[model samples]
Target: MKPAAILEAALYVDDLAEAERFYGQVLGLDLLAKAEGRHVFFRCGDTVLLLFDPKATEVPPEAGARLPVPPHGAHGPGHLCFSAGAAEIELWKKHLEDHNVAIEADFEWPRGGRSIYFRDPSGNSLEFAEPRIWSFT
Candidate 1:
């Protein structure tokens, strides 16, 4: 069977608290959970965004019989794209700027839609796009 959809996306960050505030307060995502010195999770629509501590998560869990899937982590910055409505594009730009977030790039897709790219506090690239930009949508 094919996988249904992406349930989660992860990015490693140097500071968990800063990431939490940026995602929760600035981006307006709901904070899901946080493990001190380990990770912070946020709810982005139906998907969960995980901000992990590279130093903590890079070390694989001890050989255990508990978890079926071992913990995995990545290094450096990661990227994530979020979907927004056509009507919300302008509002999103204003909101981001109001929060002092710099918009690195803005583009109108030839297919039909628009996207705004920016970076998180940890330097991970993040994008917001109108759903119609992608062919699958």
Candidate 2:
């Protein structure tokens, strides 16, 4: 059976508080949860963004109690692209700039859409593109 859609995406960060501030305050994503020094979760539309601490999540927990889903941590920077309406693209760029986030690059895709790329506090590459960028509709 084919999967419906992505439920969550994970990114490893060295600083959870900084991630929380950047995502929740700067990016305006809803803060779903934060597990102290372990991880921080944010709601990105229907999907969830999970930021975990590599050092905390990479090591398997001691015997006895264990997480239902074992931690799967990643290292280095990651990338996540979000869909935006054509008219909202400019607004998004302005919003990002207003928040002091630099636009790494902005491009008009040959296929017929535009995208803006930027980095999160942890250096994960984040992108926002017109829905048609991937021929979504």
Candidate 3:
């Protein structure tokens, strides 16, 4: 057997607060958890989006730390897409524009779904697309 599903996805940023506001306020994801200067977490449907500070995450966990997650991070922008339907894609376009977030791209996928792309404050590429872009129901 193989892995069942993705439970979490992570993106790295230099500023935790800015990332927090962008994902929490602009994108309107509910606050799940946060550790000042280290990371911020948000709930998106059944999965968790983890935004971490590169500086903090690159430093290995302290001795005796409750969770000894090893050092992990990325330098440049990463991408994450939210599942949205054709109609919801239109609503998201307006919602993001209302929040002053520019839409970098908007188009229909060749296979038969629509997608709109943008960026977060930390410059990570973001997208809202129909799950059917990958043929998901």
lDDT per residue as tens, model 2, 13-47:
98999999999998889998999999999999999
Which candidate gets the maximum TM-score versus the true structure?
3
User: Using alpha carbons, what is the TM-score of model 2?
Assistant: 0.93
Candidate 1 regions exceeding 4 Å error are 63-71
lDDT of 1 at 81: 89
lDDT of each: 0.88, 0.90, 0.92
- As for TM-score, the candidate ahead, 1 or 2, is 2
TM-score per model over all chains: 0.91, 0.93, 0.95
What are the per-model numbers of colliding residue pairs?
0, 0, 0
Using lDDT as the measure, the top candidate is 3
Model 3 root mean square deviation, Cα atoms = 1.4
Expressed as tens digits, the lDDT of each residue in 1-137 for candidate 3 is 99999999999987888888888888889999999989999999999999998898889888999999999999898999999888899999999999999999999889898999999988889999998889755
Ranking by lDDT: 3, 2, 1
How do all the candidates rank in terms of TM-score, highest first?
3, 2, 1
Error of 3 at 88 (Å): 0.6
Clashing residue pairs in candidate 1 are none
**Span of 10 residues, lowest total lDDT, candidate 2:** 62-71
